[model samples]
Target: MYIEKIQSPANLKQLDLKALKVVADETRKAVLNRVSKHGGHVGPNLGFVEATVALHYVFNTPTDKLVFDVSHQSYPHKVLTGRVSGFLGDMEAMDAVSGYSSPTECPEYDNFEVGHTSTSVSLATGLQKARDIRGTKENIVVVIGDGSLSGGEAFEGMDEASELGTGIIIIVNDNEMSIAENHGGIYKNLRALRESKGTCEHNWFKAWGFEYKYLEEGNDVEKLIEVFRSVKDTDKPTIVHIHTEKGHGFAPAVENKEAWHYSMPFNVENGSSLEGPEHESYDQLLSDWMLQEMKKDKTLIAVTSGTPTAAGFTAEKRKQAGKQHVDVGIAEEQAAAMVSGMAKGGLRPVWTVVSTFLQRAYDQIAQDLCINSNPAVINVTGGGVLWMNDITHICLFDIPMLCSIPNLIYLAPTTCEEYFAMLRWAILQDKKPIAIRIPTNGVNHTTEAVDAAYGYEPKYKMVHRGSKVAIIAAGSFYQKGENVVRLLADKGIDATLINPRYLNAVDADTLDSLMTDHQLVVTLEDGCKDGGFGERIASYYGPTEMKVLVGGVKKDLYDRFDLQQLLSDNRLLDEQIVEDVMRSL
Candidate 1:
């Protein structure tokens, strides 16, 4: 009821401690309702409810820039900042608000449109610096999770914020968990601080030249307000390390924090998933395959950058892998470089990362791994246009981002047979740093045997050899190409269907061969068109007479897009492709 009354962060300041506590309770219910209706970050938002309420009570908000790192935990903040309808209303109403913190949603309150982890501190530091430059004295607060502290940029931001020699508040929300259980040495220090109730002699925040203050009652709104009020606009940079429970309000999320970190639509009463059982996935397949291989090879390592579940390495599988499984916290850059070192030390290291997070490790991947030619296997899951419609977490750009890196072989696998074979070949081969873009479009299996030495050379497999029009589909788009082929056949146009598995390498011979019979070559890739697989194909046939139609999402940031509509807009659908081909003819 109080949550509905809240129009902005300004409204929270008007509420007393008892009233604020009521608001926090209402906010938690709103978060649970929204997440249960659709699917969203459940634990992080639930955990930060009280803290967010206390923050609005103490600070000036838009005047006092509040930056949330990753901003997955900003649901409560949104609920308070005139966006309660999205949470309280029907599933259709939820569309009004993004899952992450976005300035576009509420420019007055939400400072940044952040989805990735460990960026709050750095972003806040920049805002603080800009404020100082403009002769402003508004309090700049950064709410970062304990898990985010492991990121390289978080440390970079802390160092700069401390040296700023001005007012900046960095609130480290210590839930003692990242996406899963916390990893890295930083967590140990955090644990010490939490155990000692901030009385620890060697404080990580203090070590970084920050005036550190720890709050034991992080969830208590009155206490949070008291602590926040103490450091409203201090002259020096400070760290307000607050110990909070992840998934605080929700029973199921509280018990199993990892599983509830991000939940699919689930039953509100029992917290069981509302959706049916998951179909066979690449993630489960990879985990099953890796566990089997790890038994044979003692030196095999499965590395993850905080998101272990992304790689299908659940807590049980992680325990089974034991010392062989490594979670480098939420540090993708570190994971990228560390895997390279593991490879250099004669260890077979396979790092699985979500495609969205992979962009953070571009420099490390190019410099540390590719430049040295380390034999590291990087499996990039969630490639192409994903169900995660947030603009900050778009999976459409991985093609260009990874493919551009020299000495890095980016392979796109259309089927389980091809993916496993590529994974096997990548692990065994010690020549270059290879990345497999695991197919996002539902699991597919073929009775045909995949060549063991399929990926060694730059080549494209001709699936259906026909004349005039050629459909060179890469990765997830191969199935779409197959559909287009059938549709084209219906129209008496027998289109040539080719599966280009390797993303980086252009099979000059196969492409040249296509030129003989195919007048029009349509390159279909489930990624951005610019600088992607299709562009490479288009570039290859630039000097030739063959016309190349690059089919992929256009170069632009699509916010909370409909996947089917995105494909339709790009003319990537079967009927759309057929229509385009007919028009071209």
Candidate 2:
């Protein structure tokens, strides 16, 4: 096969347009085979196969750097860069490479380890500046999607790139979708440009001073090569806008682009999921609750930053929401600030986002929401150690980042009852900006139904009271605390077990009271130890006689770590906690 012969982009350079098309076909099959078995970004890889192949054939990559916006669309790029074996060979081979582009795996091929969207233009601009400084004339290209263009960072970078007046090729891949359908006014202009065949006076790229070129047939390798050849070795900033199908060459993905954007292991023949039925998730619960609440309150709104599916807001639910559902495509910063405005305007705004993505809006949370004291409910879903072991998507840092922000109440709920109660309180209370870290594991109803009317009092709930030792657990780690309590009881050491629901602030009164009977106070959190819930508790008891032991993952980037092994390494096991307490005593 042509794909097997392609060891690198250098090999791709040797191939003609016809041979390149053959390689693209082979790459698409490999992507489909690997993605269907192991699960990955199916539609993006399939859509961008020809574009990727054409770019590698025309550009001298590794010298002429190429950066992908989200890197979810980098599967085709990986195949061309001597990594086809990972996709085409064995099932285990797919595990050898990450879903996103990683410099660690192949420094020569992948320039950045990017998972977030709208970052390529900014990243590639930096590379261009660095090359200019080094007196190098190599090209710098950034491939960004239409959906990602809605982000503020992309505009900021594009604005700067226009002024540079150097050789920078900005390829705008207009696939007409993000993870879901594209949102924002920019998409409207994109549609106009597509309809007018790039002759529209309201040219978004041209307004930014970029020399614009558009291709009607983006999936055509010959057309893409012609477009690339026009801008090759040019000494001016240019944008090559190519209109391509999102899920090209795949009928199922093309018909339902959003659902096929990313998928679990599926039956290749029918495109049906191979995994069993999905359990009821916190996302679904939040969505259902919001729908019910919206019926009661007209001013209630559900907000998401491009990723509506993450919050379980299906297209049907979004349609039902009508004017109440707000999707500010790929703009987390805007979403945070907008929700703050909505709260100030006497509206109940609930902004649900993935924990990792919310990090981008830290400044917005601190300045726009917390400083103004807006009663906005930010539901941080996927806030702990996730099974998906990618460094860029890790949800560990949310606890530390959110907790440090002043006037922002960060709550950790262990069970569905607590989560619902916290959500209810946050939505109803007009006191301060609140963020609730949604439980990651399956639903556990250990505790009774929480009182919705009860105001948040920054107090830890004592599950079991005992003398000598007190174990304080945060959110999902509460189960571990219960297990430790059981193990302590078996050893005749009846320890006190406490669940510190409020992660940001300490319940000083309750903690001080524990000092009378408890000799040791142990704090456990399913996040980074540095600046996390455990550290706050440790600081609270610093001057006191009570010894504090903080148990959590270390302050480091944990890449694809086994969750159980990570817990054991941190001495979070029941036996280990019991042994440590015994030794301290």
Q: Kindly list the per-residue Cα lDDT of model 1 for residues 1-585, writing each as its tens digit.
A: 888988988888777778888898989999999999889999988989999998888988888999999887899999999999999988788988899989898888888889988888889888988989999889999999998888898889999998897999988999988889888888888989999999988888788888889999888998998999999998799999999999998899999999999988999999988898789988888888899999999899999998998889999999999988999988899999999999999999999999889999999999999999999999999988854678998898999999899999988888999899989989999899999999998899999888786555688888889999999998998998999999999999998999988899799999989878889999999899899999998998999999988899999998999978888888877888899999988
Count of backbone collisions within predicted model 2: 0
Over all chains combined, what TM-score does candidate 1 have?
0.98
**Tens-place lDDT digits, model 2, residues 515-539:** 8888999898888888999899889
Q: Kindly report which residue pairs in candidate 2 clash with one another.
A: none
For each candidate, what is the lDDT? Answer: 0.90, 0.89
Name the TM-score of candidate 2: 0.98
Worst 10 residues of 2 by lDDT: 446-455
Candidate 2: deviation at residue 198, Å?
A: 1.1
